[model samples]
Target: MRLAFIGLFFLCTTIYAKQPAVTPHGVETPGVQTLPYVIDGNVKVFHLIAEPVEKVIYNGKINLLEEFVKKNNRYSGPTMKLPVEIQKIDGWGYNGNIPGPTIIVNQGDFVRFHVSNHLPEPTTVHWHGMIVPNDQDGTGGTADPVIMPGKTAVYEFQIVNEPGTYMYHSGFNDTKQALKGLDGFLLVLPKDGVDLASSDFAIMLQDWAIPEGSEQIKYLSMDRNWFTYNGLAAPNFPVLVVDEGERVRIRFGNLGLMSHPIHLHGYSFKITGTEGGPIQESAQWPAATVVIAPGETRDIEFIANNPGLWRLHCHVLHHILNDTSYFAQHQKNGIFPEGGLWTYLYVKPAKDQMTRASE
Candidate 1:
């Protein structure tokens, strides 16, 4: 289907600040908030911190991958960003940045994840896909506790798992953080590697609350229906780039508190896997889109069969628009409009893309 974002929308505010400093040991210590911001140029910002440092590393960025949230804990660094921050479900500091980042890895290769948080509250990062040990699930009761703020947690594991679409996000209080935009796509390519498809596509699903007036963020608490990609809302959402007839595989997931019936336009794909884990030949399903629940993920296979900037979004319309404010209502209805700095896809046709001269 060809989705058009042809509607008017008011603007919202973008909040930027320096992250606060933690205690000597990465536990909660008394100090002023010293945040960071992206001023100009292209910046690769990890939404979470994965490990800890003795003093300060990379402006609070943990360099090593660890499995624990404290220094000299279990796992170490690798490095990362906390995907979510608590804001009143009503408004301000609810969700994280859009399409946080594209975490690309190769099969058999390893990535050490250091998921740390600086918020007042506690949380953890759960690798939605991959063979994460029980200790790394990030649940207080099930695995780990809500990692205390000012702490670095490490989760080191291999991508020995097959190559497929997967996800990652805050596993503690998952619903709130997800709906507020704390999620991302994990692309685990094959070791030998297959061919086809454009460079590579990693798409994520998430929603957020972008308030209109103040510089603070706002997210929903419960009873939410808003939807988006990498935190982008209607019209402003990023356009996926592709070449017609190319074998395109989309790595998709839902970090929202609510489940999403991810629908794609134009063609269908093979339902490869769920939660980034491999889908055995017997378990594989085929469809144009798949249904992904919170903390769940899917890998879809399809041809760029039909090209023309086809729109990819959640089937839920309300979640795509969220009324008129975009950031209003704490995104209880949807996420922030996608325009600002987070436009994911911008496909420019290289062949047969331009309009031919009419007779």
Candidate 2:
């Protein structure tokens, strides 16, 4: 009897020890924000307002040109004074933010959106890549009615599709309104409520055709000069921090005019999913860069085995810098300073190493 009791104790201890640590399941949009929702009965309710907002692409505190000049004294050029406002634009956004706030939900969940139009013109919210009723599609032509300025529209739908990355943008005058910044990410998690990744991030890519020395966004122009991730250009975007050996997932959405080949340094990842749905394991392939075209979303996952700061940026050379003409004039040997659609992934040491270091 004593032996049996000891054996049972050992089994229970082993079982409890093998249990994995509980990590919260949710998506994080660095440099952007998330929309809050309230639960009414079985439905989740979200409120959004489309309005004209002044967006700051760069805080202008980090003068890359000045740094370059200080590093290379041989180059003689005019250095921009510190604390100059880099790029600010008058654009349209939902809930007071360009690219708006991310809306996260689960498969099989019923959701309602109360979208109010505060802009000077009418608009509608179209759920990109979502399967919903015809009338609730927000097409704004013969289908859903447009939400006129100063009016509100209600859209309710049950998510019947698989878990994946999706987006929402303006339906009426889409090219003009969306280009001015009326778009956002819509992420749907699994219904089982099990998110395997230790860190899940959502990033939205956008570009603007703003001329130098101007704060207005030229929505009709196709020549984009400013590029951003989550409404922020590089050097201003927040770092994505995670522990070494942890699984990391990043969802990329592009509503811009051009495609961006987003690349990650120091590690290779698998294209696990897209805006449509998760790719089968057999269909998944290893890639260091993934091209996200307009109206598309790609989800990539990797294990953070290396403990270091890794660069994650758009490979399009022109898209990596802000104020093209300004940087072009100060270019050294044809190399420009980094600025747009760029950020770092900071991987900390493993938990065991941290514990040992403390001792």
- Candidate 1 per-residue C-alpha lDDT over 1-359 given as tens digits, one digit per residue, 9 for 90 to 100: 12332222111111211322211121110111112233223332233552211211012122111211134432344422222221122221212334445565668765566566755567777776567677866665577667787876666666666776666666766555544445556666666554344434555555544443322334453434334444433333334555555555565666655666767766666876676466776877667657877677776766565544344556554454432343443443433332211222223344655532111
- Stretches off by above 4 angstroms in model 1 are 1-47, 50-96, 140-142, 208-226, 280-286, 324-359
On a 0 to 1 TM-score scale, where does candidate 2 land against the true structure?
0.87
Model 1, residue 337: C-alpha shift (Å): 12
- TM-score for every candidate vs. truth? 0.59, 0.87
Worst lDDT run of 10 residues, candidate 2, spans: 63-72
Supply the global lDDT for candidate 1.
0.48
Q: Cα deviation in Å at residue 303, candidate 1?
A: 2.1
Tens digit per residue, CA lDDT, model 2, 81-188:
322366898999988899899998999999999999999999999999999999998899769899988999999999987888999999999989999999999999
RMSD (Å) of each candidate, 1 decimal? 19.1, 5.1
Q: Which pairs clash (backbone N, Cα, C closer than 3 Å) in model 2?
A: none
Task: Give the Å error, residue 269, model 2.
Answer: 0.6
Best by TM-score: 2
The clash number for model 1 is: 46
Which number leads on lDDT? Answer: 2
